[model samples]
Target: MKLSTRIALWAAAVVPVLVVLAGLLLLPLVGRDLRHQQDARLRDRAAAVLPSVRALVAADTRGRPKVEQNQQRKVVDAALDSGVRVTAEDGTVLLSVGPQPADDRAFPTAPGGPATVRDRGAAWRVLTARVSGTGANGGSGTLWVSEPGGLAGDQTAAVRRRVLLVAAVSAPVSALIGFALAERATAPLRRLSRRAAELDPAAPPTPGTGDGPGGGTNGGTEGGTDVGPGGAPFAAVRSGTAEVDELAAALALLLSRYDEQALRTAQALETARSFSSAASHELRTPLMSLRTNLDVLAAHQDLPPAERAEIVAELRDDHTRLLELLTALGTLARGDLVEVDSFGPVDLAELADAAAADARRRHPGAEITVELPPELRVFGWEPGLRIMLVNLLVNAAVHGRGGPLRADPARVTLRLAPAGPVALLTVDDAGPGVPPGERETVFHRFHRRRDSPGSGLGLTLVAQQAALHRGTVRITEPPTGTGCRVEVHLPLPDAGAPTLRLPARRDWITGGQRGDRRP
Candidate 1:
C-alpha cells in the first residue's frame, strides 16, 4: 500500500482501541466516586437525627409509649426532607420514608457505622446507619436513606457515550488529516521518483546550448544534471526529507563509483587486448630464431669440433635468455591483474635476509651484504615483498660491474629499517648509477638500459609490488655517492607489542624463494 494509506489505516485501527481502553480504566473509579457521595449523604442524615432518636428512646424509658410514638413521628418528619428512614428495635417499624425498598432486605444493616449498597434491580443507591443510645429502650436501631443511582450512572454513561462518539467520529477524520499530512511529506520523494524514472542512461546527455523540447539542455531539463568523469552526466534527483536526502546523496555517491568502475573496466579490457596482440607478435620472432638455430645445429652432426661446441653453447645461452624473457613477461602480466586482497602483513627483515642468501647462492662471485633491523615489519603481501627484494638483488648481481674494472670489489647491500611510521627498504649496488632523467623510466616494463643483458621486467616488478603494498619506490644515487640506490617505503604495521606468528611460504612464480620451511 501507499505510505499515506498505510498511515491512515493504522491511525483508524489504533485510536479507537486507545479510547475504549481509557474508558474501561476510568469506569471503576467513576463508580466508586458515586458510592462515596451517597455515603456522605447518609453520614449527614444520621448526624441530624441523632438527637431526635435519643429523645424517642428517653420517652420510651419513661414508659410513655404514646409520647414516644409522637416523638418518632416528628423525627421521621424531619428526616423526610433528607431522604431518611428510621426503624426502631424489637422489629417495630417506627417510620419509613423516601423511595420504597424493592424488597424486605432490611436496609442492609448499617452496624452503627457508614455503609452503601447498590440496588441493581431498582437501579438505586442506598446508605444505612445503626442508631444507638444509652437509654432503656435504645440498644440498637437502624436509619436508612436512599437516592437513585441513575444520576451517577447517567453521568458516567454520558461521559462514556461522548468518548465513544468522539472516538468513532474523530477516527476517520483524524486519519484523513494524517493521510493528508503523510501525502504532503512524501510529495518530494514522489517527484524524485518520477524524475528518476524519466532518465535515460543510453541517450547522449543534452548539449550545453539548445532550445529544443524536454528542457533543451540549458533552459531546464526534466531533472538536474550532475556531471561525471569524461564529461558524461547523470540525473541527480533529491527528496527534501533529511533521511531521504541522505539516502539520495548516498545513492549519488554509489552511482558515481559505478561509473568510475565501468570506465576502469573498459580501460583494462583495452589494455589487455593490446598487450595480448603485442605479446603474441613479439614471441614469434624469438621462437622462430631458436627453432632455426636448433635445426641448423642438428643438421651439422659432422661439422668441425670447435665450431660445433661454439654453436651448441650459443644455442643453450639463447634458449636460457628466451626462457627468462618469457618468464619475466608472464610475471609482469600477472602483476597487472593483482587485486587488493593479495596484500597482508610482511616482515621486511626476513624478506631481505632471504634475498641476500639467494643472491649469494646464485652468483658466487658477487658479494652481497644485508643490514636489517630484527623486527622491521610492514603491511604488505609476502609474495610481492619477496618479488621486489629478489628483483633488486638480481639486478645488482647482473649490472654491478666493478670487480676487474678498477680493483674495487662489486658489492650489493640490502638494508631495512623503520623510518618514522613507515618501513624503509633500500638496495644499493656499487655500479654505474642510473642517469637522473632515466630513474623513473627504469621502472617501465621492457625499458632497459643498453648495458643490461637481462629482461627489463626486474624494476617493473619492483614498482608493481610497491604499488600493491600502497608504498612508493624511488631510484637515486647511493648515500656514499658511488652506486645506484633503490628505496621502498611501506607503511608500518599498527603499534603494539608485536605477536609472533608462523611465516607463510612465498610464491615461486612471483620471484619468491621456494622450499625453505620454518616450523
Candidate 2:
C-alpha cells in the first residue's frame, strides 16, 4: 500500500477502537445517573406524602373512618406516579396504592431513604419515612415510595445504540480525512523521485565550471553551487521540506562522487593498456638481440678466445640494455598511475644537491658544481623530483661533450633559486648544447642520439616527473654558450600548503608528448 493509504488505514482502525473504548468507559456512568435521578424522584415523593400518611394514621387510630378515607386520598394525590404504601407503628397495614412487590418481604424493610430493592426479575428504588403525631398512641406510621429500574434500563440501551452508531460512522470519515492529508504531505517526495530518475550522471559537465542538470559546480547545481546543502542528486532541487531536500542532496553528492571515480577508473584503464603496448613494442628488439647473441655463443663452444670474448661482451651489453629498458618503463608506468597520497613537501635545493652528488659518484671523470640553500621546500612527490633531477644531471654528464672552445673534462653545474611563487632549477653542461629545433623532442620516449649508450627513456622519465609535480622543463643554450641548459620551474608551497595535482593528460610514454611544447 502507499504510505499515505497505510497511514490513513492505521488512523481509521485506531480511531474507531478508541471511540468504542470511550463508550465502554462512559456507558456505566450514564446508566448510574439515570438510576440516581429516578431514586431522587422516589425520595421526593415519599417526603411529600409523609404528612398525609401521619394524618391517615391519626384518623385510623382514633377510629374515625371518614377522616381516614380523606387522608388516604390525600396521600395518593401526593405520591403521583410512584407506588405508595403506609403501615402503623405495630405493622398494621393502613393504606396500599399503585405498584408494590408481589411479596412485601422482598421490598427493603423500613427503607429510611432511597435504597435499591430487588425482587424476582425486577428492581426498584424504594424510600421510606416515619410519620409522627403530637403524643404516644396518638398518630405514628411509615410511608414508602418505589420507582422501577426498567425506565432507566430502556434509556441506557438507547444511549448504547447511539454510541455504536457514532463510532461506526466516524471510522470511514476519519480514514478519508487522514488519507487526504497524508497524500498531500508525500507529494513533494514523489516529485523529487521523478526528478532524480531523470538525472543522468554520464551527462557531460558544463564548460567553465558552471552548474548543469545533474552536475554540481564548485558546491552548487553543477554550476558550482552548494552541492553540500539540502539539494541531493542535485543541490539545486529544493522542495521546501528539510528531510526531502537533505536526502536529495546526500544522494546527489554520492552520485557525483561516483561519476568522478568512474571517470578516473576509465582513465586508469586506458593508461594500463598503453603501458602494456609500449612495454611489448620496446622490449621486442632487445629480446631479439639477446636471443641471437645467446645462440651464437651456444653454437660455437671451441671458438677462438678473442672472438668468444667479443661475443660474451656483446651478450653482456644486451642484458644490461634489457635491464635499463625494463626499469625505465616500470618507472614511467608508476608515474602514470601516481595518486595524491604519493606527494609531500620536498626541499627542492636538498633534493637537487643529492641528485648532483649521485651523478658525481657515477661520473668521477667529470667535474660537478652545485649552488643552492640547504632547504628550499616545495609541495611535491619527493621520489618524482629525485627521478627528474637524476635524469637531468645524467643527461648533462653524458651528452655535455668537449667544451665549446676546447677538449676538457666534462663539467656540469646545478643551480637552484626561488623566482616569485615558483622554484627555479637549471643544469648547464660544458659540452655541446641541444639544437633549437630538437629541444622539445628529446623528452619524447625512446628518443636518443645514435651514439648514446643509454636507454632513450631517461629524459622521458624526467618529463613525466616534471609533469607529475605540476612543474615544467625546457632546454636552452647555457649562459656560457658551451652546452645546453635544462631549466625547471615548480610552484612554491603557498601559506595554505595545498597539495599539487598531476597533469590531466599524463600518458607521455604513450604519445602524449605532443602537448608538452610551449606555444
TM-scores of the candidates are 0.66, 0.65
Highest lDDT model number: 2
Instruction: For model 2, state the Cα shift of residue 85 in Å.
Output: 8.0
lDDT of 1 at 417: 85
Q: Which clashing pairs does model 1 show?
A: none
Which lDDT tens digits does candidate 1 get at residues 179-248? 9998998887777666455555554333333221111122122344443333455465555588767656
Clashes of each: 0, 22
Q: Residue 515 CA error for candidate 2 (Å)?
A: 5.4
> Once model 1 is optimally superposed onto the true structure by TM-score, how far is the C-alpha of residue 57 displaced, in angstroms?
8.4
TM-score of 1: 0.66
- List residue ranges in candidate 1 displaced over 4 A: 49-82, 86-98, 102-123, 128-143, 173-278, 288-322, 336-345, 371-375, 403-411, 417-424, 479-483, 494-519
lDDT of 1: 0.66
